[model samples]
Target chain A: MIQVIAFYLFATLTIAAGALTILARNPVHSVLWLIVAFFNAAGLMVLAGAEFIAMLLVIVYVGAVAVLFLFVVMMLDIDFAELRAGFVKNFPLGLLLAIVLVCELVLGIGAERAGGIQLGTPDGTAATAAGASNIEAIGALLYSKYLFLFEAAGIILLVAMIGAIVLTHRQRGGVRGQNISRQVARRPEDATVNMQPEVGKGVQL
Target chain B: MTEFFQTIGMTYEWAWFVATICGILLIALPLMLAVAMIIYVDRKIWAAMALRRGPNVVGPFGLLQSFADGLKVFLQETIIPSAANKGLFLIAPIITFTVALLAWAVIPFNSGAILADINVGLLYVLAISSLGVYGTVIAGWASNSKYPFFSAMRASAQMISYEVSIGFILICVVLWAGSFNMGEIVEAQKSHVWIINGFVANPLLFPMWVMFLISGMAETQRAPFDLTEAESELVAGYQTEYSSMSFALYWLGEYANVLLMCALNATLFFGGYLPPLDIPVLYLVPGWLWLFAKIFFFFFVFSWVKATVPRYRYDQLMRLGWKVFLPVSLGFVVVVSGYLMYTGHFA
Candidate 1:
């Protein structure tokens, strides 16, 4: 009964917040609503017994991604009218994308309801061993069964990151930056001098 | 606790719900009280370092100073700026205070004494702590002011920079402990090296502990790294435009975060609830006392640093977090994991 209530609560809030993410006037509010949607989606994952995935969802999406979203959105000097001006121009493309997404969702759910397509027969070897926690089970599978695929995914992410950096990074001339190592390595004697001079005599450089 | 509630003739679900509420109260009420007293202690530490008395009039040795200040703030009218995003402005402080308290649920005060003994306890802490940035970010934006906005920008950037290194540092601990469960992490440290009751005793882990301590300080926005509230630069930072109870909540929330960081330091490195030595005779004392002692010790270290160290330049802070701490911690993660694998520790 509690699970039922929790499921409904999370489901409702997820939908509502997701809708608000698009509907909100302020970009900052939109980002915050998106975060709320992410949180509720994490809750749904938890209810599905994917606690590890749920935590990663919260940590990665809500924590890091949404924060960056909010950071960018908050800084934007938004013109609401200008934003709305593009909406009509973009409507056909948006509608096309939404229809495609809805079609994919319907097909996916229909496939699941029609019984999952079997690529291979399930072997007990891949099943989560009894008494193992979700994390352990996932770890076992990830490290043993899907190690190459996992590493490939990591490599893909790394390549994407480097690509982004390369695309955005530029060198500007005449910009003097701090040489922290040089500063640290400098001795007092190297930067200073002690001298005794007679009256009206200046210390030599 | 659920069983205790069940004795009163409630159904299992109701009993569980009531027990959870009771548990929350148990942790939160004392946490509130602790935050208040910690403020006084922080002042005294700062005062002693500066050769002055701190908050001596409100109560004996200024024991009631925080309470008196709380009362004053409570009595003051909440002043909302006409230009501020009013709803968000008010919600910001509550978010700070609540998120500060939320992570405590996963912290094991003693053996089997955790409120939420979830498998991914440490991850839960990470997730909740990450949420803390939103309070400052929202407050800064909602204030609709210059300084606060700058402070908020600094805060968001600073927090994100430090969190990267902090995450890597925590990974080293998690690798060494072989568990993401907070309770298990603490348990794994028992007699970790010979008679030592902490991972800190290990030569490799000691450096990680030091890095964790410093990163923890930065993560909590404690002094030396408190660029968000560097008054000489940004007034009170995100709280510059806040007034009344809202301001007080920031105060309470900041100290609470400090305490939480101190507790994390204790738990992660100093063998939370475990005596420094693993002698059987030492186990006679209650675990919670040992935890409290470790927490107080770490808190003193925090306060001492706050008193003695000067604040960092913003660029320098970023440099340390990224150019220094991040690479070192990431390297340590590899080194620690390799050592664990080589030693067959997981086996």
Candidate 2:
């Protein structure tokens, strides 16, 4: 009964926050609402007994992704009037996309209600133990059955990161950046000269 | 707590509700008092290290200084700038304080004595501590000022930068312990060897302990890494615009965070709530006392570092975090994992 109450509360808030994420005028507020939605969805995942995944969701989305969103959004100097000017112009396309998305979701759910495609056949070799925690189950599967796929996914991410860096990175020829190690390694004698000269005579270079 | 409540004549749900409330008070009230005492201790340490007499006015040896400051701050008006986002400005400090306290829920005070004995306790701590940056970031934006905004930028960037190395360092510990549970991490350190009490493993070469300590200092925005609030430059960083209890909340929250880092250092690298040595005779003293002693020792180290080390330049700080700490910690992660697997530690 308590779980039911908690589930409903999470569900209500998730829906409310999702709605507000779109309806909010301020971009910052919208991002915050989206974060709230993510948090509530994580709570819902927790209610569904996917505690590890729920934490990952909160950790990845709310902690990193939404923070980036907030960082970018706060720095933006968006003119609401100018932004609104494009709303009507893009309304038809947006509406069409929304409708198509809704249709896809509906059809997906309907197909699942009908003879749904089973993602995989039950393999006794990789079966999760009854009492194992979600993390344990995930680790078991991820480290064994899906290990290659996981490695491939990791490689793909690595490639993408490298590609992004390669694509954007540029060298400005004359810009001086601090070489901290060089500074630390410098000895006083190397950087300066202590010389004695006759009185009233300047030290030779 | 629920059982205790039931013995006092209450239904199960009511008992549970009462127990939770009581638990919150038990942690929070004491934490507040600790923060007050810790402030005095920090000042004294900082002063002593600087070869100066610290607070010697209020209560014996200025022990009540924090309380006096708190009362004064409490009496002052919560002045909101007309240009500032009032709601967010007010909510920011509350978020900071609450998030600061929330991470303590998973911290094992003694064996099985945590408020929440969740399996992913360390991950929860990471996630909550990450959320702490938001308070400062939001405060900076909400304040509608440039200095505060710049401070906020520096703070968030510095925080996120250090968190990467901190994450990898924690992964090394987690890999060493073979568990995410804080209690298990402590127990894993109970090997008969005194040197192996920490997850450091191979003390001379394995530098994860020092890395974790440095990262913890950076994560807490302490001196040397305290570029965010460098007074000469940013004029108190994200805190410049804040006043009254709002400002006081930030102060409390920042110290609370500093204390939390100290606790983490104790829990992760030192024997948390466990005695320094594994001698059975030493177990006579309570676990919580040991935890407190370790916490105080680490706090003194924090203050000592603050006194000794000069603040790093902003770019130098970034270079240390990204260029230096990240690679070293990441390399150590791979090394530790490889060594563990080779030794069949998992087996």
Candidate 3:
């Protein structure tokens, strides 16, 4: 009974927040709503007994990604009228995309209801082992069964990160950069001089 | 606890609900009191380091200083800036204070005495800590002010930068413990290095502990890493525009986060709740007391650093997080994991 209540609560909030993400006028509010959507989805994951995935969802999406989104959106000097102007011009494309998405959702649900494939249930071998926790079960499957795919995914992310860094990084000839090691390594001897001079006599360079 | 409630004639679900509520109160109420006292303790420690008396007048040795401040804030007007985003401005401080308290759920206060003994306990901590950035970010943006906005931007970037290294550092600990469960991680530390009761005693892990300590400080936005609230430039940073109870919330929440970081340092590196030496006679002292001692020790360290070390410049702070800590921590992760594999520890 509690599970039913929690599922509905999470599901309702998720949909509401997702809707608000698009409907909100302010871009910052939109991002905040998107975070709310992510959070509720994570709650749903937790209710499904995939606590590890749920926590990862919160950590990666709501924690890191949405924060960047918020950061960018907050700094944007937005023209509300200009934004709304584009909405009318882009309506047909948006409507077409929405229709395609709706069709895909309907077809996917229809296929699931028609028993197109025998996806395993919760009580099957896919369920966590009798004594093992969620993380251990996932780890066993991920490391043993899907290790190559996981490593490939990690490599892909690394490549993307490096590509971004390389594309954005720049060197300017005139820019002075602090070498922290050199700064730390400097002693009174290397960067300084002690001299005694008579009156009206300047120290030599 | 639920079972005890069940014996009181409640249904299992009701018993569980009641037990959970009781558990939350048990942790949160004391946590509030502890935060209050910890503020005073932090000030005293900082004061002693500076060779000055701190908060001596409010109560005996200024014990009631935090409470007096709390009452003062409670009675003061909550001034909302005319230009500020009203709803979000109000919500930000609450978010800060609540998120600070939220991570304590997974913290094992003693053996068999955790609020939420979930499997992914450490992940939960990481997740909650990550949400902490939102408070500052939201407060910064919502205030629609220059200084607070800049502070918020610094905070978001600083937190995200440090979190990357922090995540890798935690992976090393998780690898060593072989479990994400906080209780199991604590248990794994017992007799970790011969008679030593901590992972810190291991030569391999000692560096990780140091990095984790520094990252933890940065993550909490304590002195030396507190670029977000650097008063010289950004005038209290994100809290510049805040006033009254809203301001007080940030103050309390900041100290609470410091305490939480202290707790994490104790739990992850120092043997959490275990006696420093694994002697039977030491077990006579309660586990919670030991945890408290470790927490206070770490808190003192935090206070000492705050009082002594000068603040890091913004670029230097970023340099430390990215250039220095990031690569080292990431390399340590690989080294630690390889060592574990080579030693057949996993096998």
Candidate 2: RMSD to truth? 2.9
Candidate 3 residue-wise lDDT, B1-347, digit = tens: 99999999999988998999999999889989999999999888888888899999997888999999999989999899999999999999999999999999988889989999998999999999999999999999999899999999999999999999999989999999999999999999999999889999999899989998898899999998999999999998999989999999999899889999989988988889899999999999999999999999999999888999999999999989999999999999999999999999898
CA RMSD for every model? Answer: 2.4, 2.9, 1.6
Candidate 2 regions exceeding 4 Å error are: A111-128, B6-14, B192-196, B200-206
* Candidate 1, A64-118: lDDT as tens digits: 9988888888889999899899999999999999999999999988986676864
Residues A1-205 of candidate 3: C-alpha lDDT, one tens digit per residue: 6678899999999999999999998999999999999999999888877899899999999999999899889989999999989999999999999999999999988987787855435353335677988888888989999999999999999999999999999888997889878989999899788888999999889
Instruction: Give the Cα-based TM-score of candidate 1 against the true structure.
Output: 0.97
Candidate 1 share of real interface contacts: 0.74
Off by over 4 Å in 3: A116-126
True contacts preserved, each candidate?
Answer: 0.74, 0.41, 0.89
- TM-scores of all candidate predictions against the true structure: 0.97, 0.94, 0.97
lDDT by residue (tens digit), candidate 2, B54-158: 998999989899999999999998789999988888999999999889888877888878887788888888888888888999999899998899988888888
Instruction: Say what the RMSD of model 1 is.
Output: 2.4
**Higher-scoring candidate on lDDT, 1 or 3:** 3
lDDT of 1 by residue, B1-347 (tens): 99998999999999999999999999999999999999999999999999999899987878999899999999999999999999999999999999999999988999999999999998999999999999999999999999999998998888888888888888888988989999999999999999999999999889888988888888889989999999999988999999999999898899999999989988999899889899999999999999999999999999999999999999999999988999899899899999989999889
Q: What's the TM for model 3?
A: 0.97
- Cα lDDT, model 2, residue B169: 87
